[model samples]
Target: MRRPYFDLIATGAKTIEVRVGYAKICKVAVGDSLRFTSSDGSLFTRITAVKEYKSFDEMLDAEDNTGIGEAGMTRDQLLAACRDIYPPEKEALGVFALHLAPLPE
Candidate 1:
């Protein structure tokens, strides 16, 4: 999660947690529960759905800015930011989109 996106997740404005790393993608499954902490506070979330993509660009195309909007960023900025974090080679490795919902406290 990124700054405002982290905030969005905390506030329930964002409900998807996107990951391009194998470590996270491999471990998570639908019905899984996760806890996260950020400057806003702590959050508990449940995985409701999981989607896999062959590439980040493909994922972006399918998503059509839904996640970016939740992050309060334009498509270009989000893409650029992702590129900065994940180079082209890594992006091509693929991504996982996890649909989330707040879990009961």
Candidate 2:
């Protein structure tokens, strides 16, 4: 199974700042770097800065394997991909549909 992870939208996002709990992940830190290609096919780097921490927000394991690395799958790309995969059904419950449905809502 693909590891479940969060994709911070690059749209209107000045910089890809991943909050690993309270501490923000940075590129220069001694951390693991992950390469990602946006939906526009732009090459970008993602770094997992914080390794160990205790916080209220769910923490992502640096070693946890997860990614949908299709070319041109930037934040927007992923959203589109997901929408295509799980399109809205005609007779779906409005409430449940809202929750299970993909982003871009």
TM-score of every model versus the real structure: 0.79, 0.22
The C-alpha RMSD of each candidate to the native structure, in angstroms, is 2.3, 15.3
| Candidate 2 lDDT, 2-95, residue by residue in tens | 2222233233222232222222222234333434344443324434333332321112222221233243345555444444443444112110
Give residue 81's lDDT in candidate 1 (0 to 100): 67
| Candidate 1: Cα lDDT at 34 | 85
Clash pairs detected, candidate 1:
none
What are the per-residue Cα lDDT tens digits for candidate 1 across 2-105? 56667877778777676775776767889999887776577789998888887766777777466444545777776676677788777666787788889877
How high is the CA lDDT of each candidate model? 0.74, 0.29
Error of model 2, residue 46, in angstroms: 5.5
Best by lDDT, which number? 1
Error of 2 at 17 (Å): 6.8
The model with the greatest TM-score is 1
